[model samples]
Target chain A: MMHSLLVEGFGVQNWTYVLVGITFTLYIGIAIWARAGSTKEFYVAGGGVSPLANGMATAADWMSAASFISMAGIISFDGYDGAVYLMGWTGGYVLLALLLAPYLRKFGKFTVPDFIGDRYYSNTARLVGVICALIVSFTYVAGQMRGVGLVFSRFLEVDINTGVIIGMIIVLFYAVLGGMKGITYTQVAQYCVLIFAFMVPAIFISIQMTGNPIPQLGFGSQLADGSGTYLLDKLDGLSTDLGFNEYTEGSKSTIDIFAITLALMVGTAGLPHVIVRFFTVKRVRDARKSAGIALLLIVILYTTAPAVAVFARTNMIETVSNKPYANVPEWFKKWETTELIKFTDKNNDGLIQYVADESKNELFVDKDIMVLANPEIAKLPDWIIALVAAGALAAALSTAAGLLLVISASVSHDLIKKMINPKISEKGELIAARLSAVVAVCIAGYFGINPPGFVAATVALAFGLAAASFFPAIILGIFYKKMNKEGAIAGMVIGILLMLFYMTKFKFGWFGGGTKADWWFGISPEGFGTVAMIINFVVSIVIMKFTPETPKDVQEIVEKIRIPSGAGAATH
Target chain B: MSEKSNAKAYWKENIRYVLILLAIWFMVSFAAGILFKDELNTIRIGGFKLGFWFAQQGSMYVFVILIFVYVRLMNKLDKKYGYDA
Candidate 1:
């Protein structure tokens, strides 16, 4: 169906080159504009970040390369059921802003492990917390590296592995030099690049197709396929006619959807990098204010993602039908050579059906490349494609830097401060943090070149690990007065191990092959984190009930954090 | 430990507010999206189905509203307890 957008005499090769050049210069300029100073500045932007600036940075950090690249892919394939990711991600922010942000800020910690250690009054709990944080952070960062590789490979025609390394170097320079301070400012700039890149193509397509200025509302509105049916409703008719669930209807097990959504919410709150952003604020109230603002900015991108997916899919079907294969846009030939997109004229009609198989009813596009392909499928210009390439890079690099910082903080701040050298000077520990950042970048680059799955699919595992281990222990420690160190440690260890088994069992098909019939109440690996979380909560509560109470001193510590009072001023 | 700590009373009240708001949050998201979706679907606003909208856009808008509500409520809670720091 998409083979027809190519007409004789239209070529955008030159325009693509110019757009890519401008985006690169803009990012470097913005990075220099928001340079870092001092260890304090490097770590938390000197705790002087206005909620507005911080919001933009946090939005960039939170959205990541996956949201920009893979979310539309997911929506394009899964149709209306894909709204779960959209709702889960945006909804998770509500939990972050209200339930977790203020209390963690009041604890006044440099990292997530620091808060867990202090709250539980046990180094054992801290160690477990650090391990979980590392696993989640690394797994997610690896996906970002792969995205960076894809963007670089597509535009520059560099080796994919080389592109990954290039991304690592750029990220390492700023993240190592400036820490949170540098990353924050760069992320704000990155957000601007990404959002503009996303909206420009979307707006162009919407205007061409639906005469609508807003790409978001255009999703549910009628299509311009000249078919005179609502876009989703047409997709519904197309897919359902071929035996697919209607585009707006859901077909997945409701239990699985509920569980996966739960896991994602907890995971978002538990992520160390995102939570640490709150600690950058001066006052506890400011932390709450910052999260509110951060969430507002995040929604701007998150809400628009699903809409873009629907618009792109509807346009793709009409664009590709009944035309010669060579007549498809030059972008298809271009992307196909990269192996990012493929075409098969399913019905042997010399035209892509794109509709569905009567048996499966699934659209054939690779969800990972949906955002990049959407512009071309809609037959927009080449500059938008180049902008998408740059935006994908920005998304990948910003989150990679954020995750790498969290890993370094765990090593130098928690592990080194407590175990390696308890008496290490602050100056020395700070150096260790910088060195740790470099090491993490190298490792993430390695994983990026050799990725485990499509970018978003890979990061979803990180969310699972976070939900299973960190979320439960932290929430219990903060809210449940009876939860003690032993209970927390036991819960985290059990939660993480169980989640690992769940993930490996399916991904590797260990113990015979394929998905098991009995998956601890039939929860898919995608939703295992939610189940593990509930288990952790239950285990901690049951054990704490039988064990002795939290020590009086620990109780007092909890009381202190609960109050919104002084961390006082630091003269530095 | 100090005479003017004010923290103890401040914490007690804050906990109450969080509990109440969080309960509403869960009901809107989990309950409305999955648990009571069938019932809600029967009630549509305009061309959009209520249950689907809740799952797609409604709950998110509500979640945003809830946070701002939390912000105002927390501010009032802070000022009332004389712990606005």
Candidate 2:
């Protein structure tokens, strides 16, 4: 198994080690090249990146380790229901481009809270915005670090804790030194590495399975083994035979899925790390164009994910179903060592059985392992395996760097400079930002070593929190000129509290365990955010109607921002 | 027309474009992908059930296209309004 691969001097581990070393050096070099010299550069890359480069960096920032590593696995296991993620995450960009990005760019802010603060003209609203940003970004960074740890643990044979620490150090080196200026350029490089790594194995697997080189088309193509069956048809039949839902159909309640998808869409638009990227662009037009190009770059991976899921699912069934345990492939055995995949002879038979019914199923595979183990499962060359390892690291590091930057900015810019010490000098603020990044990376590393939840689930909570809290507040701040400070603050507090209450009540059983039946409208905790967001809108509109009008100056600023003109240099 | 009227008219046109684009965005995802998914699944496209395709693949493509379309339409609108950067 993996031991054999490790025994050879020029094996997969060696390749992975070399590639990771080279990639890390390249990223650090970029960081050094793009090093920040001013507060503006530290926060927003000196507001100078082109549309295309910003688009690429935004794509890298948006597509986290969860998207690269676990998305395909989730699709494979969850069947058609997983489409919620693909659509929800991507469609939000449309909302960003049309509704938020242009106006925010015209406003010319350094951070998301800056928009909320100025729009509402309230320090309290600004503070609330910063809290939400920190929570969402911190929750998200922990998952990226865990993704880094997982890849390192499997490929380098390091303990997960050591892997997390190593990842933290590397991110700390680039993120603290380079700031947004450094992180932005490094992310573009990471995007190239990660996407190349993602597509290679997918192309190989597709060619092997259906003689189709394009993974997107391979899923719908006929089997290459003369089976005269569409690949999905084969997977559907196999799934039904194994007591699983049909591959192209869903079994979850439609309402729940709908709510979750909506939550994720708004959440994506509301994300601080993503919103802040738009601030780094040179002009309002670049902001609009960048959103388009970012989605296009992102689509390259998002479109391929379902195809990878189909191939992995079909290959796994064909390879392992009804097979004797002793004859299982090396990849399965290797994954079993990590306990991500488990097998039991339930019927006292030596064969493994994978089925939907727990009583009859003999194999238990964690969904997160699918992407990490995919290249090995396909029996691709050692170099491809090494590439996948490097790609996963790139995905994890790129996202972690973005999230850490936002966290640092929230601390240094929003909390310290704006709230606590308004007179803090530019040099002092830059020092605080770098210091906050170091501290933030340390906390994120701790969470990576002791993850609060599974990678995708923890990331989902972050999305839900963002969707409920920030999305409504910011959208109202932009689109509803009459939305006053009182309405904005009230809506955000109520939205976040309701979401936290529901998640804690359901997810952790705080104030006693709440069952699905106890769920209001039968909405899952993941979907509850959408409902909470609705409540936020209702409360804000109602409160705004009863309150005094927004100040004349605030209304004038809103009118000006909507026009996308006079976007002079952003000032402190 | 006064400069104020020009800005006002331009904002109106911008809103119209956004509404049109967002309508398509909503239909493809929430309608074709979810509400009409069962009916769409009754139809097939290559190896894909139509609803399933919209859910996992089709909607995302439409999203990307919509944004780019927004970009193009906005660029024209910006030029007309003398807001081109």
Candidate 3:
């Protein structure tokens, strides 16, 4: 178990140990420094986090390991079709800012279920919200934990299960100790480390590719190798030459791309961890302001992703194409041992001839390795490689901590305090939240050891599920006064069940077997959430007509949440 | 204007701004990025096809601008309605 695995005969194990050790130590130190005493402080950081600080925390929480480690790899492989992620993840913030964040802030709640329960005047609505939150957040946290495991296994030479347990223990210490207060402050530090770590190597690669320091401009500038060709134009040509789709043109059907993008956007808006960040700020106005700032911070990394993808893709082609298998670079050899990048001489030519056709193509590379291996692929220094590892860990840990907090809050604050035992004291609720955090972390760690799907795919499913379940309920609750509790509860159940059915049928083929050819209107399972959301909306509207209106006080509360006026301190 | 009327007027203005901003949002992401991408791809901007730019990079820029526009418009409306924090 303690055997040393050499990466290129260099002790990456030592570098990873030092860097990860320092970051984990620093994070725990911050958690101890920022420990919360009261439930209010623990849940929403006493509702006094500055807009800028809160924005940074929100960005860190929102951008998970999928964004840091796998997104560039996805874009590299999917080409223009990958734009769905870029547009979907960022565009959802607009919905959050305009439709949800401000009103939720005015409601001044500890958790998203608090709003659902109070707004609908039904414990059923609250419990439904709590369940959806747990499903989405736990699914999300499991993916992040897997990301943590991946970084440790590759960098520290530890097994993936050990990495997951280590990540869980560190997350439990901070999450149980500081709660949201600790998580928020720690995330701000994480944001600084992650963005800087993400950008330095990107800048280096961009300059090496196009002679431009800015990755964004470098993506469009002429190749620095004196090819006199634009970077994307070169990439598109290389891609098409290999039978891959043009780098800038959509390959998937138009409707599928549209549906997937819509689902991710709506799901992002409905996410509990992201929504809870809005509650930490003091006022409705600050909530709006914080969302804009978060987007600004997130867009910096997001916009860089495509450029990095292009750089990684172009470099990969030049390095591997027409080269003998024996001459493959050290990085290529290293990755192959992990089986993330595979090569077989189908033609027995002893040369690496990569093509889009799987039958003839000998080189197969997993998309997730592209970002993590970018430094090595470019022959960058070891320190930069170590920094990338640290950054990936930070991104994964920050998101996992935030998600565990939400899962704990939904269980403790919403389910236990609100329903199971209404007379639970403040101290008792705090203990329950901490206890739930420990249990949720253990569950998430288990999932990390046995992840269901690819990191980005599982994360996408989390978003899709959230969109299908929570987005409609919360939106209708705020905007439509006549939507009764019965309608809301029924809509959630119908929406989530439809999504689960489609996903299991298509993605897993759980009940008998279903395939893409049998897809309804040719919509894939990833995009099915969009259709399910429409069903939720339609079902809610139709059911509202047949049911009685919401109570008068509930209508008054809805009106009160809309106006920014009378927003006082959040009650414990 | 009375407080209730002022609040009503402010709410109307807020809705108007949200509508206009949402229109821009819809155009950039759904329309230009998806429906009109092929048409716009005929024209290249810098190294990116116009449509490709909108899909990967351009739409995100527009979204950020849209949010700030909402913030600015809502802040003014809040001040008008005496709801500014």
Q: Best candidate, TM-score-wise?
A: 2
Q: What tens-digit string does per-residue lDDT give for candidate 1 at A1-572?
A: 34554553323444555665676566666667666655566667777777777878888888877888998778777865676677777777777876677788777777888878888888888898899899999989999999988877777778899989888878888888778888888888888888898888887877776667776666656656676666666766666765557666667777887887888888888888888888787777777777778777767676677678777766666666446675777767778888766676655656554444543222245678778878877766666777878788778888898899899889988899876688987688779989999999999988998888888888887888988998888787777766898899888889989888888888767765455576667677878899888888888888888887899988877776676767542222
Tens-place lDDT per residue, model 3, A226-281, is 97889998999999999999988858899999999999999999999999999999
Q: Which residue pairs in candidate 1 collide?
A: A1-A319, A1-A320, A1-A321, A2-A320, A3-A328, A73-A367
DockQ of each: 0.55, 0.83, 0.82
Error of model 1, residue B30, in angstroms: 2.0
Question: Which regions of candidate 3 are displaced past 4 Å?
Answer: A1-11
**Residue lDDT tens for model 2, A1-572:** 77775675477889999999999999999989999999899999999999999999999998888999999999999999898889889989999999999888889989998888989999999999999898889989999999999998889989888999999999999999999999999999999999999999999999999999999888988999997899999999999999999989968888988998999999899999999999988888889999999999999999999999999988898889988888988888878877889998999889888889999988999999898788888888889999999999999999999999999999999999999999999999999999999999999999999898888888988888998888998888877888999899899899989998899889988979699889888789988889989999998989988898999999988889988767866677
lDDT of 1 at A109: 72
Candidate 2: residue pairs that collide: none
Error of 3 at A93 (Å): 0.5
DockQ, prediction 1 = 0.55
lDDT (CA) for every model shown?
A: 0.77, 0.91, 0.90
The DockQ of predicted model 3 stands at 0.82
Residue A314 in candidate 1 has what lDDT? 64
Place model 1 in a CAPRI quality band: medium
Cα RMSD over interface residues, candidate 1: 2.0
What ranking emerges by lDDT with the best candidate at the front? Answer: 2, 3, 1
Best by DockQ: 2
Instruction: Let me know the TM-score candidate 1 reaches against the reference structure.
Output: 0.93
CAPRI verdict on model 2?
Answer: high
